[model samples]
Each structure stands twice: as C-alpha cells, then as structure tokens.
Target: MTGTPLTTILIVDDEPQIRRFLRPSLAAQGYAVVEAASGEEALARAAEAKPDVIILDLGLPDLDGIEVIRRLREWTEMPIVVLSVRSREADKIAALDAGADDYVEKPFAMGELLARLRAALRHRLRQAGEAPIFRAGALAVDLVRREISLAGEPVKLSPKEYELLRLLVQHAGRVVTQRQLLKEVWGPAHVEDTQYLRVYIGQLRDKLGDDATKPHLIATEPGVGYRLLVELAGDAQR
Candidate 1:
C-alpha cells in the first residue's frame, strides 16, 4: 500500500533565511514545503501548489500579508497562519479579521510555531465537516443543538451572549476581532460600540463560570479581540 500523501505547506516570506529556516523543519515532519518570496508570487504559487496550509509573513515586498489574505479568501478557504515581526495588537487583529486562521509573532519558539501550524491544519479539517463539537477543559459546545455545557452541567446564556460564544466557537483557537464580533452579533451600526461587547462578554463569563481575571475559557486579546480557548473545532449554533 502507498503511504499517506504529505500535507503541503506554503511558506510565504520575502526573506530567504526565513524560508530556509522553515523548510527543513517542516520537511522533517513529513510536510511538503512550497516557498514564495512576494505576495504576487505567493498568489501564483498558491494557485499552482494548492498547499494545504499557508504560513505568511506580513511584510512582503509587493503587498501586505493582510491584503494577500483578503485576496486569497475571495476564492479559497485555506488556513493561513501568520508569522510577523509586528508586535502591535492591531496588526494581529487585522490579520485574523482578514481571514487568516492564526498568528505567531517573530522570533517565535519553533515549538509554538509548529503548534500553531498544526492547529491551523486541524481548523481547516474541522471546516471540511470533520468536527461538530468544540471542547476545551470542562467547556463543551454542541453545534448541532446549540447546546453548551461546563463540567457536564448545562449552561444557559442569553441571546447576545450565546451569539457571541457561538461566534467564538466557530473560530475556536483563532482570534475574532472586536469589530468582526460586534458587526456579526450586533449589526453594522454597532461595529464601533466596544461597550456592548464588554457588557455581554461579562455576562457570558458569569453564566459560563469563566473567571474574568484568570479566565480559562474565553481570553480577551486586550485591545484586539477575543479568542475562545478550544481544541480547533462548528455551525450556525443557533
């Protein structure tokens, strides 16, 4: 019998050293590596390689990674895990909101970067109908029935709170920007209303028994957005 096909990963970074750095590591783990040095090249290569995942750097000679993400999203739903030197939370939010699956800062630990890559691949698989339930620690979300439970006990949530949590569950392990969450849940008119998010998130936390300070479930991304700490997993969820 033939061996399983390797998972192809596109490394889109203008820096040769960065590409060099990632190629061997990824190849060693049985991934087929494809490299692109510019956003334009990346677009072309993505079409040619049909990589299973993309590891992108925000600084490209031709176009910003965020724009690349948007352009790629126009046709494909492939997972993009960003690798950027940019430390600003705004940058992180921009990438995540633009359709990237995850982000890892520059000078990142190889272990962490590898973990993010694995998570992104898992996310794509989930999107492809592999996972319907999201779970992390004691939290459980049933996408089919729009049910949520903590430590085996049902947790009740109001409409807005449930909507927010559902959105997070949909993007589990990835950051969902504030404007995105607000616009999706509250409507376009409320996109800039941060206060509404704060109030509702607090209510959601209380109902889920997630601590505000030492949160174990939903972790606030400071000024960026919120990320549900799930195991890469679902649906309309009501």
Candidate 2:
C-alpha cells in the first residue's frame, strides 16, 4: 500500500462509514480505490477493476466472505485481506483456510492495517514470479532440474511423489485445495479419489523425512489441501 503507486484496491463492505474511513487513507498512500457494497458487487468489481488487492468485509449482504474467497481463488490468485468485525479466532482460521491471505479485525489501527496490506501485496508479487529453486530450512528443491536435496544430500522421489511436491512448492505458503491438487496431479478422472492422494502424500512425506504429526515441510489443512511450509531462498518473510 505504501511502496508503489496506482495499485488498485477493492473495498468490499456494506457500511458507508467503513468505506469512507478507508478511502482517503488508502488514497493518501497512493492506492486507487474501488468500492463495493455487497458480495455480488464485490465479485463483479473484482473481475472488472482487476484490483491489485482486496479489503473484504465478512458480513456482506449476499454471499459470505468465505464463499467469495473460494470462488475468486478458482480463477485468480489476487491477494485478499479480510476486514471484519468478527473477532473470533475461528473466523480468521476459516478465512485463511478458504484462501484469504490475511485478516484484520474492526476498530483496528490504520497503520497496522496498511502494514498487513503491504505484506500481502508483497507476498503475492513474490509468488507471481517464483524461483526455480526453492528452499526451507535444510530442504532444497531444484524445480527446473526436478531434483531435491536435504541438508545438501540428494533425495530421490518417485514420479508421482515429485509431481505432488512440485505442485505444493508452486503455492508454498497458501493452501491448495484438495480438488485442485487432485485434478492437477492425477487428472480429472481421479479427482474423486481422495484416498489415492493420501497414499501419495504419505509416501512423499516419508521420502522427505517430514513428520505429519508435527509437520515442518508439508502441513495439511484437514479437509483442505496441503501447503509447503518451506521458505523461498531470497524471499524472506515480511
């Protein structure tokens, strides 16, 4: 929100006061603002305006914010930061699991809100042009070479295992839905075969020495898909 100019931001909230409050502040930071008062409007404006980031309110008139996140994620990877009055930690987890990048409660500090927005945008941009080589802790994956190593020692993987790992690495920090993983890795015919995916994931974990109980490399989202918990070499956490 602070660094670059002309970065469009979509504000989705039913309340005028909240929109008014954020409008000038975001504009002052050199962001172009688009407003939507309902869930339907939010989706429409998102496709039309093509905003760089979205500040979404959970209690929209039409659709729930979680649904919006899921629908948008089907085609787009734009950053979404939920700004809502729901203070329950469960709501935050649900939003993130549904594909929201960040969450901010109402009556929040303007500075902190702006800071979160900036971080989300920065991370999205980093994922846009991901490096061929990815690293987390001591594990390294050379995506271009289709090779993997742990603590500088070579690790071999089967064809299916490598494919699954590659998909997770592509969307490192974000949750990848089980359906998306199934269709991409095993093709459309095997999308309903969740058990097949479970077997392969377990196999990949064993080869990578990743413990499912207290996972450090691959973390599962229960009913959702997996996320690579590794850090990209040059992309430090903001």
Candidate 3:
C-alpha cells in the first residue's frame, strides 16, 4: 500500500452552492472532503477534520478570509487555496501573505483549481525534505548534489543564488514571503534585506532563461513575494 493516507480537503465557504459544487468534484478525485460554512466553523472544523489541504473563501459571513488564513498559519501549515470573487491584485496579495498557498478567483476553471491544489500539496511534501530531484519543465534541480540544469545544460549559480533557488524549489508552488527568504538565505539579521532578493531573483531568472516581463517559471506576487510556477514542468513530481 501507499505510505501516504487519503488526503482530506476542507472547503470553507459560507455559500451552500459553493460547497455543493466542490464536494463532488473533489470526491471524484478520491479526496475526502469536509465542509465549513463560516470563518468560526472553518477554524473549528479545520481542527476536527485535520484536512491535508484547505479551500477557503475570503468573503465569509463572520470573519474575513484573510483572518482565517492568519489564525490557521499560527498553528498549522496546511496548504490553503483561497477561492474568492475578489480579483483585485491587492486582495490576492493579502490572502497569500496571510499564508494561503494559492489563490483562484471566482468563476474559476475546475481543472486549474485542481492543478493548483495538487501543486500546493506537492510543495508541502517537498518542504518536508522528502524529495531529492525537482523537475520543472526542462529545468531540473538536484538538491542532493546542489545542481540546477536547464534543458540538459548545467546552469551556473552563485552560492546565494543556489540557496535561494533551493528554498523556492523546496516550496515550489507556494508564495515564499520576502522576510522568510531573506532570513533563511542571508541570516536572521538580514530579514529586512528585501533588495537582496530583488537582485538575486533577477540574476536567477536571467540564468534560468526566464524573462521577468513574461515569466514562465518565477512569477512575482507583487508587494508580497515570489512564487515559482512550473505546472508544465510537472512541479517536481518526477
């Protein structure tokens, strides 16, 4: 049998229709689903359900969705996917910064949502130090050997650049905050050094053959942090 147990997805939305729409979709994918209608219930059910991933709605009847994300982050790192009608960039950034793993606006395609959910889960597994090789499209990162290659060609990176890329690869699909990256890569004393990330990220993108204007791998979250998206690369599954 499989080493990992069945994954439970917690749906936190005040709208009955929303829950109904998601339940069967997730169930069809063999995921056990738990539903909560409000922020308070979301918190309680999250504790009771012990879900592996969470799909949260920001416009809850009681507490704001961001608040739910914040409270949950305090105790757990369960992958959270924020589903909301708010398409504004600021709202998306806020939810992400509050600890949501992915954000999908309302009227979303089911396929995209499912893909994002999978990425979120994959990210958590990688962050647990469970993976040695990470593959994103033609780019491959061999963490054990501290090597990165693009399309079979070895890409050179500075020590700091490699460290940053390694960390991002570990949490591949998740938005890693600037503070966390700085602290981890530059030391705790440099937590405020976001410019370091700006420069390094640029250098990394250039080396990885990624264009900042139309990035296929590393995408900026704008005012929050950066997220690496390599869906076509299979998100390190291989």
Candidate 4:
C-alpha cells in the first residue's frame, strides 16, 4: 500500500520507541506520519499540520492527554484516538468523555490500530462533507433542510438534539464520541457532561422508536458514544 494516498496521522507520545515503531509501519501503509512528544507540541502541530487523525498517548510529561483532548476540542472536530497503558474501563471512558473518538490499550496490534485510524478518518470525512439526505425504514433525514421524520410524522427535537442528530446522520455508519457530539451540539463548555448526552440520546432513540438492546437505527459504542446507522433508501426524496 505504499504511496496509496492515505490520510495524514499525527502520533503524540513521549516515547521515542513508539514513534520509531509507528512511523515506518504507517508510512508503509501509505499514511503521512507526524510525531509530537508532548501535549503542548501536539496541540501546536495539530493546528499547523492539520492531521486528518491523531493517535494520542494519555500520559505525557507535561500534561494529561484528557486535557489535551479538551483543548483540541475547543476549535477542531478532528478525530482523536487515545492510546494508553491504562487498561481500566474507567480510564477509557474518561478519555472517551474528554473528546477522544476511540481508545486503544498499549501493546496493541499494528493492524488493528491502523484499521481504527482508517475508520476515524472515514468518519471525519463523512461528517465534514456534504451528506445526501438519508432514509432508513420509516425514518428520514434531510441534510439540506436539517429536518427529520419518522413514520410519516415530523419529529421535533430541541436545538441541541437536532444538532447532535444531524452530526450523527452525517457520519451515519461511524462511531462518534460523546465529546465530539457535545462539542458539536452544546459547544465546548458542555463537553464534560456525559449525562446531558445520555438524556438527549435517549430522547432521540425514543423519538425514532429505536430499541436500545436491538437498535436498528441508533447504535451505542458501550462507553464510547452513539452512532446512527441511517439506512439510505426509499424516503430520501421526501
């Protein structure tokens, strides 16, 4: 896959060995890799380099990766995947709640990491670009009008819920983190409020008649966040 025109990825880790191990492998897979050794540097490079995705290490010499994620969420919607030695679910949830799109434990498989990176990039692209109006079953979403309907009935949502649902619809097939959804809907100030997200998501699911257990439209990524798997057919023209 060398020179295959893959997206650029930034690797933020204090460990030289990690960067060394990742660079060649990522390059071999056709990604342009940039490295930053500290949170400060990562933030600066992210602004300047504008990497399509970020592989962030939670433990840094100068700052916590969560803080870095918080700061980055202020201005950018770029995908961030947390890489940490801490395998605890709480730690992973914390990162996910802090604007990380996904988390990977240390000593991870290179292929798995790369695959995750690709997914993140795909999600970002889907979110940023112009999305076609979508329909799945009786549900319909019009991107141009920012409207939604279910079973031939107009569904009303709060301003925040509408924005959140729009974002999920844009990224239809991909996972979106709580932090990303919060930032998009409530702004950066509310990124830490996971409960706010829970309530809004529940409201959305109820409106869509989505089953939490066997959800056909809205899918949850456990401790991560929610994704709306919009089925694009039939009612799109409406």
lDDT of 2 by residue, 8-107 (tens): 9999999999999999999998999999999889999999999999999999989999899999998898999999999775677688768897777898
- List model 1 lDDT by residue over 34-127, tens digit each: 9999999999999999999999999999999999999999999988999999989889988988899888889899887887777677666666
TM per model?
0.87, 0.64, 0.81, 0.62
True-structure RMSD for candidate 1: 3.5
Give lDDT: candidate 1, residue 144.
76
Once fitted onto the true fold, the runs of candidate 4 whose alpha carbons sit more than 4 angstroms away are 1-6, 134-238
Which segments of model 2 are wrong by more than 4 Å?
1-37, 40-51, 55-59, 63-77, 81-123, 231-238
Q: Give candidate 2's TM-score.
A: 0.64
Q: Where is model 1 poorest over a 10-residue stretch in terms of lDDT?
A: 229-238
Which stretches in model 1 have alpha-carbon errors above 4 Å? 1-3, 130-132, 212-214, 231-238
Measured on C-alpha atoms, candidate 4 has an lDDT of: 0.81
Using lDDT as the yardstick, the better of models 1 and 4 is 1
**lDDT of each residue in 123-206, candidate 4, tens digit only:** 666566555676667887787887888888999887877888887776655567777888888889998999999998889888
Clash count of each predicted structure: 0, 0, 1, 0
